[model samples]
Target chain A: EPEVTQTPSHQVTQMGQEVILHCVPISNHLYFYWYRQILGQKVEFLVSFYNNEISEKSEIFDDQFSVERPDGSNFTLKIRSTKLEDSAMYFCASSEGTGRGGRPGELFFGEGSRLTVL
Target chain B: AQKVTQAQTEISVVEKEDVTLDCVYETRDTTYYLFWYKQPPSGELVFLIRRNSFDEQNEISGRYSWNFQKSTSSFNFTITASQVVDSAVYFCALSDFNRDDKIIFGKGTRLHILP
Candidate 1:
């Protein structure tokens, strides 16, 4: 089965440094999303992208975060300046616009990129 | 606002024992979707099951079963004759159809099936 793939399985960076995580969603998927989970915590939605633009974002996705579909298959999340609290596992997910019978599409998630800020 | 609550933070069961993880959700929208995902020690989120608001029929797949109750706003998962391989953190998530389909996940319940 087709699956989402993320790069840099693990990353360590300084608190003030920048970090970028990459993801390649399923070819036919039109909706992409970024989510993060702190250690032993619930997954939090950061942002959602559709039609090559941000469809919605959560309050946690402040000015420091940005997402881009830089290429046909690549979706990237960039943090201008990483903070210690930013250390977490970032997951990329995608879904084919809508499922049969007009139900919401089910999301397929990647293995996740673990970011550790020192 | 939509929310998913997995009340059991962690559970331990002997091999071959049956186990159930509780999940309760809150969503104002009548049309929504509920899902369960498993996160192994490798830290990958694996899709397990998905149920829409209209489907309340209890589903059974092999040793796995799901119970979705709209009246009580709960979607529970059960593992029958679980094995060591079933040890993982299971997450219950929700998505509102009226919203942009962004999933809201619960804190997850870590299941340890000891041999």
Candidate 2:
């Protein structure tokens, strides 16, 4: 089956440094999202992207965070200045369409990229 | 506000034992969705099941079954005759159709199936 793929299975960066995580969503998917999970914490939604723009974002997705679909296939998340709290596992997910409440769309998630900030 | 709660932090069961993971959610949207994902030791999340607000019908797939109770706002998963391969973290999630925000995951329940 086709699956979402993420680059840099693991990354370690110093505080105040920049880090970019890449993901290639399923070719036919129309909606993309970024989520993070701190160690021993629940997964938190970061942002959702559709039609080349962010559809929604959480408080955790502040100015320092940005997402881009530079190319048709590549979706990237960039943290301008990483903080220690940024250390977590970032997941990339995508869905083809959002159906009604009776048949909501299901997301396909990538393995995840583990980010470590020192 | 939409929130998902997985009260059981961790659960252990011997091989062949049946186990249930509890999940409760709070959502104001009349139209919403609930989901379950499994994270194996390899740290990869696998989608297990998705239940929408309109469908309260319980479903069973092989040894895995899901109970969706709209009255209590709870969606629970049960694994029967569990095997060693079933050891992993299971997460219950909620999403509102009225909003563009992504699914919200609860603190996962780590399941350890001892041999």
- On TM-score, the leading prediction is 2
DockQ scores of the candidates = 0.63, 0.63
Which 10 residues in a row give candidate 2 chain B its minimum summed lDDT? B95-104
**Model 2 in CAPRI terms: which quality?**
medium
* Native interface contact recovery, model 2: 0.54
Model 1 lDDT per residue over B2-114, tens place: 88899999999999999999999998898988899999998888878889899999999999999999999999999999999999999999987656357899999999999
**Each model's C-alpha lDDT?**
0.91, 0.91
Clash count in backbone of candidate 2: 0
Error of 2 at A68 (Å): 0.2
Give the per-residue lDDT of model 1 (tens digit) for A1-118.
8999999999999999999999999998888999999989999999999898998899999999999999999999999999999999999999887554233647788999999999
